[model samples]
Target: MTDTIFSARQRLSANMRWMRFIVLALAVFFLYSLAQDGFSGRDNVESMTDHLIVLFFCCLHIVFYIVFDRSKVLEFDAGFLYVKSKNGEEKVALSSIHIIRLSSIRLGYIRLWELVYLDEMNNSKSVSFQPLDRQVFSRFQEMVKIANPVVQINRFRFL
Candidate 1:
């Protein structure tokens, strides 16, 4: 098997990190401001509504970050696949992959691709990224065919 490194688009990844950080900081600042007000009744309904809206957005960002933005490295080499994430690193054999799903997800204003697959242990794992190399899909199809011909592949776009 050829040694290939498939990484997330660096610019998009960095932007995502920055956005998450800013949202979290804003949430903290909002909380501090609310505390200074002694949690009083909504004397100013408009101001209270605006604060709630910001808090709602901050919560959504945290949920998405935990569920999707985890993968760090995706490397396929020597018939094995290496996935490194914030949680940990897992090495899986290509033959163990049964199904592959490629889909797009829209987060706020940006659209990113998600790669999901089922492993031998029957666990569904996914990585959200935009390929730095355009040949990534072709290389993946070629490798999957050679390693496991019966692997089911599906592609979809969510607009």
Candidate 2:
């Protein structure tokens, strides 16, 4: 029996847009204030520190969400990987794939797996998601090799 390479049942990329928007709002609010009044006086300095603290906590929340907010994954028994994300659902056939480009995308301190598949139509589709389990990601990598031996694997690094 062929095992599932990758599977996600819940919306992994869902709620991401809202989180980013919240962070952006915090930045905009504080940045405009900073521009209006230059850093001066003890009271202004104290107020700026308080706002900075709020910003730091907001960023921390995002980091926690990225690391712990995992999705549910069952199986892809149909020989197709079913993806349900913020962008909706899509299924890519294993056999119709000509290339599987592997990469990573980062939002804040977290990193997600990026898969770009070249389908039979010569079109490329990309999926960015965190696997339900780390073991699943390793298994998926091996499965990619078995499915498309000539697939291009990119080694991603953060400096």
Candidate 3:
């Protein structure tokens, strides 16, 4: 079998979108404060503090986007499943996955949760990852089915 790699662009979650909005609001407030003070001609201390606070919040928002906004794709090839990220990659042997759980959220979103067998300590470990689109999830499910037909998948419940 040939090894394959799949890559997809990640998007911010709904929760992150709200966070970005809050950051934008804070930036606007900071600008308004500066404008009210006649382009910051006076109140040097207050202006500096306001500008610093705005800068910190803007940095926080940017950091969050960098960490979570990228999409990840699952690759199954040559008896291995690889989870790749911008920083690094993780690989799990197909046979080592004890369980493959499928869960859905808000109607259309599918999350894949894997319970993997740790070879070093002979213990089980759980990990979860989300695909960029429903089609990707479907492809993942199909690949898992073909590779490990009897793998048990726990249904995810939300409440």
**Which of the two, 2 or 3, has more TM-score?**
2
How many collisions per candidate?
Answer: 0, 0, 1
Instruction: Give the residue spans of candidate 1 off by over 4 A.
Output: 1-19, 26-42, 108-128, 157-159
Q: Which candidate should be chosen as best, given lDDT against the real structure?
A: 1
Q: 1 or 3: which has the higher lDDT?
A: 1
Give the backbone clash total of model 1: 0
lDDT of candidate 1 over 87-131, digit per residue (tens)? 776777777766665555665655455555666677887666544
lDDT for 43 in candidate 1 is 67
Scored against the true structure, residue 98 in model 3 reaches a CA lDDT of 62
Local error of candidate 2 at residue 58 (angstroms):
15
For model 2, the superposed segments whose C-alpha errors exceed 4 Å read: 1-18, 24-78, 96-109, 157-159
Cα RMSD (angstroms) for every candidate in the order listed = 5.1, 7.5, 7.8
Model 2's TM-score against the true structure: 0.48
Clash list (residue pairs), candidate 3: 10-71
